[model samples]
Target: MLKSSGMWWYEQFARYRYRQGMTYARKGQYHLAISRFNRALLHHPQPDEVCIARGLIYLRLGDLEAALADLDRAIALNPCNSKAYGNRGLVKAQLGDEAAALEDWRVALTHRPCYAEARYNRGLVFAHQKNYQYALDEFDLAIKANPNLAEAYLHRGNVRDELGDRFGAAKDWQLALLNDLSLDAAKKALFRTRRESHEQRLTEKLGAVLAPLDLSLQVERQGRQLNLLIQREPGTPVNYQDVAKLLQAKIVDLNLNWLERFRIIGRMGTGGMPDWDKVYQIYDNCACPPIYLSRILASLLFFMPFGIAAIVYATQVKANYAQGNYRAALTASKLIKWFYWVSLGVFSATASLVVFGVVLLLLRGESLSSIIESIRTMPSPRPYLGRPYADPHPDPSPQPSLPESTDSSAD
Candidate 1:
């Protein structure tokens, strides 16, 4: 017979059977595991642990009645078993007896005060009953017991939101994601709250500007910024530049949590509505796009036409610069560097292809030598003029010859 471990060589049948039952349970063979647990209980002195393990399996399989029976028997065997009470609470909760489930949780908590799982379960029940204050307390206790509990933070955030503590809710959601990055619900909650606050401020401030113009402001989110489209009568005359300037001047004093850019589109000009990009920031250093001297110098040195043209355009377009057009400014300022990199990229690719072809040709030449050698080594490839490389077709005409030496024997 083969033993599984050194301890298994002398282990008793009851403990062995219990371990096998646990192994089968871990492998998700519920029915086979139940039979193994039954067999182990017949020989084991303590049946509470076995019953608790089997009950958990039954609970996972959705057999509430069997799980409840097993848990009740486990509690009878050991009145101090907090696990039995806690899991029985879950079964009762599923059975639609909220009052009895709460009672079970109370007993479980009394048996083990620091049980984080029990506290979390109680928080869910409290939240469901709309007792948000009690739910918040339970979740706080659970988090205190186990600081890394992401679900506890998540539910606590919901309770805080229900209690009108939005700041606390946002903080809780942030903490939940810090503990578990996979909590996308928490991540979305945080993003939504931030966007709401930002858009609310924008609407109030920007909405006031549109009041006197007989226009309505429609704000649509475009990534991290807001796109403001001024809605008006089809034939109404409106200058895109004037509206953009008005929006920019009024938005300078506003405070925001997230938005930094606002794109304004007013009435159609000679062309359609122009997209006016203005970036607003609280900090003085970020109020305008930065102008780096090194960038201009590098552009002028490596790429000539783009650097010179961009610098000239940047200087000529005073209104464009004053309007804080981010994209145009980047193009003017970074054109030289962009061109230098693009040219270098193209040259490097060509050089790489050439190098690869050279290496391939060398390898091909080496293989050709093997073929040539093999042909020469064959029995007799051809009756050539004692040289394998000689031309097979000999010239029939007499070749040009040097003058014969005067002392040659004429035989």
Candidate 2:
């Protein structure tokens, strides 16, 4: 009984020494921790926990090889030690052996399912792989295990943003900031995502309105020269001859109207590519308002190959229909313009499919085919201007009544 009591006392003394070593290690006193750990080992010849404490201290001191050796001895003595696996995984990750790190983390998780740090670390590995969905799932589990985990929230928010779930990203970032007010990363991410989302919505609204920009513009270039023509509206009559004369003189002076007014709008560098951008702006803002539709079509032609001409014309023709310029709209129908019609018919089916796909993608359900079909079915106009024809024999009008009689005889 006395010997057993002495053994117990020795065990307590060894544990005390091990704890002192850990405390010193935590305070960055590596030499003191090492000295104490050595003393503990002398007192208890084979103490696995003391060995673990010494190994962790060695790790904290950056003696990774010694730390790993101690950890191996500790694990061999206590085969079920979960913390041993976790520490090893940390070392492996530091060494950039991600697979080994992952394996160790999985083993640790198998022993302790609620290990928040392990889960967070594994999630980081997945994130580095760009497997955002997997990373997010791991982060979600970590957060569930430890709701106060600000790091988990931040990482999850980053993954959400990458997945294009901006709202979810912002929510996670906001939550992270709320829990850990000092986490500057969380705060910055929240602000950035919110601003990006706001800007994205603004762009979408503008995109919807400006999708028709491909309709009202035209561009043509002859060797070493480019010309952009915006057709004037027939309905809104202007001095065509005067404008033509002005254009001729400007051409002679090599000073087009767009070049003069371009400076008023923005500098050339604002749009990067001047020729392409200048043409689009003119189509959108020029006074040849009806011709605006044609200008946009011409710009589309200039950008894409000649194959896009039909699609651009279709878009312009549809815009014209929307504006009630039925004559110009009808003239735009490729079938009525037999020259363009014959050109289209000559294309192979493969080319036709390509053009059709491009048109559908650009139009995005604008009903171009139906508009063109309707315009084609309408009869060609005669050389005359008159009110839109209703039914020639209109519904019978009420018979006209005679004026009232004097009625003096009746009175």
After TM-score superposition, the amount by which residue 9's alpha carbon in candidate 2 deviates from its true location, in angstroms, is 3.1
For each candidate in turn, the TM-score is: 0.56, 0.49
**Candidate 1 ranges with C-alpha deviation above 4 Å:** 1-11, 211-326, 330-411
Q: lDDT for every model?
A: 0.77, 0.65
**Which residue segments of model 2 deviate by more than 4 Å?**
1-3, 43-46, 201-411
Q: After superposition, how far is residue 370 of candidate 2 from its true place, in Å?
A: 64
Best candidate according to TM-score: 1
Task: Report lDDT (Cα) of residue 195, candidate 2.
Answer: 56
lDDT of 1: 0.77
Whole-model alpha-carbon lDDT for candidate 2: 0.65
Cα misplacement distance, residue 209 of candidate 2 (Å): 8.3
Residue-level error in angstroms, candidate 2, position 3? 5.1
